[model samples]
Target: MLPKEAYDAGHYVGVVAHSTANNGDSADGERNYESTTWQNAFVHFFVDDQKIEQVANTDYICYGAGHTANHLGYVQVELCQTTDAAKFTKAYAMYTWLLAKLLFNRKLSVVDGVTLMSHAQVSAKWKESDHTDPIEYLASHGKTWANLVADVSANYKEMEGTDLKLQTLILYSGDADLQVAADLAQHFCCPIVQVAFATSDLLLSATTKYQVGGASAPAGVTLLSGADRYATMHAVLTLLGK
Candidate 1:
């Protein structure tokens, strides 16, 4: 079951794998009694190689976690298996596919060094009770949960920077009626007026103006602000093809 917030926020995806045995059969078995029993049943969505099963409503709270049962913004995806290498391959594939779908549908980019924690992250009780599932399974595959999260966060940051650049260009072109010149001046730590005038000879004069011990004029340009404002503006316009 995909959480509404996962769909709404368009970013986060949660994956869970069971550590304990599902029913009487081994982790590789297709059917388990634990999956059938109402009292012992836990988790919302269960994934097997052959099919996906939904046990609880994504919108409602499920009794998957012993302590933290009511996490407001989490999607619980459970793998129907125990800690077995054979079952882990299928589980890995399922989790990877789910993650891909979540990222694609939500337009999320993963960041490097971000932490993808587990149920243990939220609940101390679960952690203290020796309850470990996906974390162990993931470690066996030589992938830490933190690394997975970092991958997502790194991509997310890259995409965000790209979006900001596009927005800056649109504003600078005056298409959005934004004060991009002022914004650029503030970002570059220079005077707006000086930045405006230096736009004409930015490539050539900027280096000299910003050079150490250079005669700094308004906006750090070498040229004086008086009388030369018009000439500077004209040069800038010509260079910009305005």
Candidate 2:
């Protein structure tokens, strides 16, 4: 078992993102491995294509980066590695969203290299850990550090004001669907979000939900979907009397 320790800062100052560096691993597999080797190193959460699995409580510190980051009270999360493009896409969505959720939960703004950082940033800044990860792996999937930051910031913005009223929403999965969804959103004055799964954390309460292409909205969301993308767009437009 890992030793129990509180952060030197009392509460977490920010979040650090890491990758398992072991290709083709799932969150469950990573958590299982950490279960044995946690004394060496571990993080709070592991994210893969299917789910975000919590391995340790973020209320306490976990030994992920180096002593500097750990003692500074930075919440660390690991992204499980995968080779398959589709799986990587799915996992990346969840990973970014999870990071944003963590920051939002703490009421922290998404400030790249400060509040939200890649493991590479942590290594470079602290100089205690020689490891730089998730950066190269993300580049393999055609994503840049800027891209991750933008996505996380977007997610953070969407989740910023839960008390605000957003009566309608448009959700899309692919590029084509996004075009249609964008048109509908502009026409109907509804918020639009890209989603990867039926049970996405991005789901917000709305009187009507417009789901396009592959992704499904969460259950009991008053969803409007069709047999196809065009049909779904048509349904949304017609319902709004377009």
Candidate 3:
């Protein structure tokens, strides 16, 4: 389940619902909603034997996707039955409707290349030992995760810039700080600066000198300052590297 804020914040991308038959025997009794007098009886949406049940608001997070709270970002829908042989026509319809609503409400293009990932994509731990869900069932029906990702990526603008770089600065002070700075710098393909200034206040001052590639600080370069001069310098250096 997701809260309205999550969707409004662009924190979540799409929805996913599972068929109950995949969990165990189909004859298992249904969820007893009478036990709890809540506004919604089931998940945000449910794909059952015959139809898609809109039980709750799509904005609320439900009790699915295992233990990871971040998974709450996804709109989770579950089917009443779980079996490999279960027909997914109803599930597909629900998914289509959910996507239509999300795209329309969010002002996103229907062909926008945004991902609709499975729980497995968010956490490998869920499938590391033995557990598997949509992936397994989808595979049986001639679908693949790669295909899904590709489809979303092709239609979503947000998915296009996966390789964009963010510039940062990292400063080093302690013995290990230089190593950390260097490692991060190498990763970001950026410059690393080494500087010495009086007082922690000047450590990060925009006017502080910085060394990069054994070169002195260029003209117009500014420095950062803070209470923990050394740590702050290290952080700046690391960020620069990044």
Candidate 4:
């Protein structure tokens, strides 16, 4: 689930990766990362080869950023190590895609590092850890923070064009067609938000429908749904182009 106040207030997200794993979202790595309950170290999102797992609640604080305010203020995302060339490309692409979706949903800039930062950079600036996991990793791959930011712009711009500014709300369930909503968010690339409670009727610029039986849509919501999660995900990926 997305954060309550964080999404409401548009909190920045910090992206970090472990350098030692040398592979994508290893099961052993998830256990090690999640099991370290002793320290104030935890992340909200975990990125790997083909999946982006939400480990912690985003509304709360993650203690992974290495600084007090950084930890408390930003959403933290941890990536499995990316040393292998093929693994890194896949992971990096997924990271950017997930990030563009998240940032666009949060009303943050997809291409802006002020909102998205590397763990190494944030730690170094704030005097946190040794401060060199992803930096070293990026250096080895001939990519830099600059390259990453550029990629965000390219990826997001290519995927989405128009900017939506409505207070976005996403009502997703494992059973319901969740990817449908996530796809709309990916392309419209606006700051529409999700809410725990909503009014009896929602007013939007487009036409949308609800899957439930009792609820009602006032007007201006449209219908355009997908078949499955995979197709739905890709559909949203091309939302901006539409």
TM-score of each: 0.42, 0.68, 0.41, 0.55
Candidate 4 shows a clash count of 10
212: Cα error in model 3, Å: 68
**lDDT for every model?**
0.43, 0.84, 0.46, 0.55
Query: Model 2, range 1-242, lDDT digits (tens) per residue?
Result: 66768898788889999998999999888888889998889999999999999988888999999998998888899998988999999999999999999999989899999999888999999898888888999999999999999999999988876545466777777776788778878876988887664344445456567666664555545455677877877766776788
Task: Evaluate model 1: give its TM-score.
Answer: 0.42
Q: RMSD to native for every prediction?
A: 10.8, 13.4, 16.1, 14.8
For model 1, the stretches where C-alpha displacement exceeds 4 angstroms are 1-35, 67-73, 82-87, 99-116, 125-129, 150-242
Better of 1 and 4 by lDDT: 4
lDDT of 1 by residue, 1-242 (tens): 22322323342343333433352233324234435653544555666655565655555444555533334334455655535665666655655455434444445333221213355554443343455665665676576767546544554555544444421110122222124334343445643332333354343323323211112434433332222334434433443366
lDDT score for candidate 1 against the true structure = 0.43
- Highest TM-score: which candidate? 2
Which one wins on lDDT? 2
* lDDT (Cα) of model 3: 0.46
Q: After superposition, how far is residue 170 of candidate 2 from its true place, in Å?
A: 26
The superposed Cα distance between candidate 3 and the true structure at residue 211, in angstroms, equals: 68
Global Cα lDDT for candidate 4:
0.55
Question: With candidate 4 superimposed using the best TM-score fit, by how many Å does residue 72's alpha carbon deviate from the native?
Answer: 4.7
lDDT of 3 at 112: 20
